[model samples]
Target: MTAAALLLWRDFVRDPARRLWTEDSGCGEWGCCGSPLEARAFLEGVLRGMSRRRSRELRAVVDALDDAY
Candidate 1:
């Protein structure tokens, strides 16, 4: 992710009220990576019954891609 993308994702995910998805969900903070399409895809894939390991792998992708890291 670029600086702008990182900022967008951080601001969005940090805002509790503005969160794109419900809290404490199985998907967790699944849709706050600065991309609505990416988030949607995450939600769909997870809700579609993907394994927990797969979910972690997906999240790892987000963490790795985030420029803030």
Candidate 2:
């Protein structure tokens, strides 16, 4: 990954609830919880969709998650 991507991954992998709050002040779903690896994968999928110019798809993927906030 590029330095930026790696950095973003690091930020995303840190405390998933905090990450959600950092993003949007949260809609309050982080307590639903998931494994760290799961959170990372979800974040990566969202990032990939965004990088590919697929924001709607990205939102769909993110929003579909119970832990997304």
Candidate 3:
């Protein structure tokens, strides 16, 4: 996956999966299971798809929640 994400995929990020601590194969529907990064990526992608500005605002709110917690 690391090799494929880097040298092959050439999508989203420029670096490989090894370089991304948040990168996930996101293979869950198949019952293979996945990591938190995959879930995070999915949510983030959804947010960003709506609007990058809105996503940034949402992220700031999440950060504030963490800080308050």
Candidate 4:
């Protein structure tokens, strides 16, 4: 799911017209992100909502991305 989200985010960044999907309902069924920041927030929200054991590695990646951003 993390890898898929990253790939979808990459595609969304390249083309804002594309829609991104998320299991987190807070992000919307198809995700209503209008900008990279919003998309990042959506991704982070989803990651944060996950169980600690499941999200540990993904949170690390997200932290790294946040630092780079």
Per-candidate alpha-carbon RMSD to the true structure: 10.3, 11.2, 11.9, 7.6
Give the better candidate number (2 or 4) by TM-score.
4
Give the per-residue lDDT digits (tens) of candidate 2, residues 1-69: 333333333445444555444433434344332233445565666566565565666545444442443
lDDT of each: 0.48, 0.46, 0.42, 0.60
Predicted candidate 4 versus true structure: per-residue lDDT over 1-69, tens digit per residue: 445566545655555443453344234533343345555777888887899899888778666665544
Q: Pick the candidate with the highest lDDT.
A: 4
lDDT over C-alpha atoms for residue 46 of model 2? 54
lDDT of 3 by residue, 1-69 (tens): 322222222332333453453444554442243344444455455556766665676566444533432
Question: What TM-score would every model get versus the actual structure?
Answer: 0.29, 0.29, 0.31, 0.51
The count of backbone overlaps in candidate 1 is: 0
Model 1 poorest ten-residue lDDT run: 25-34
Q: How accurate is candidate 3 locally (lDDT)?
A: 0.42
Clashes of 3: 0
Name the top TM-score candidate.
Answer: 4
Flag clash pairs in model 2: none
Model 2 lDDT-worst window of ten: 1-10
In model 1, the runs with Cα more than 4 Å from the true position are: 20-69
Model 3 segments more than 4 A misplaced = 1-34, 62-69
lDDT of 1 by residue, 1-69 (tens): 333443444555565655444344334343343453355445445535757766676556556544332
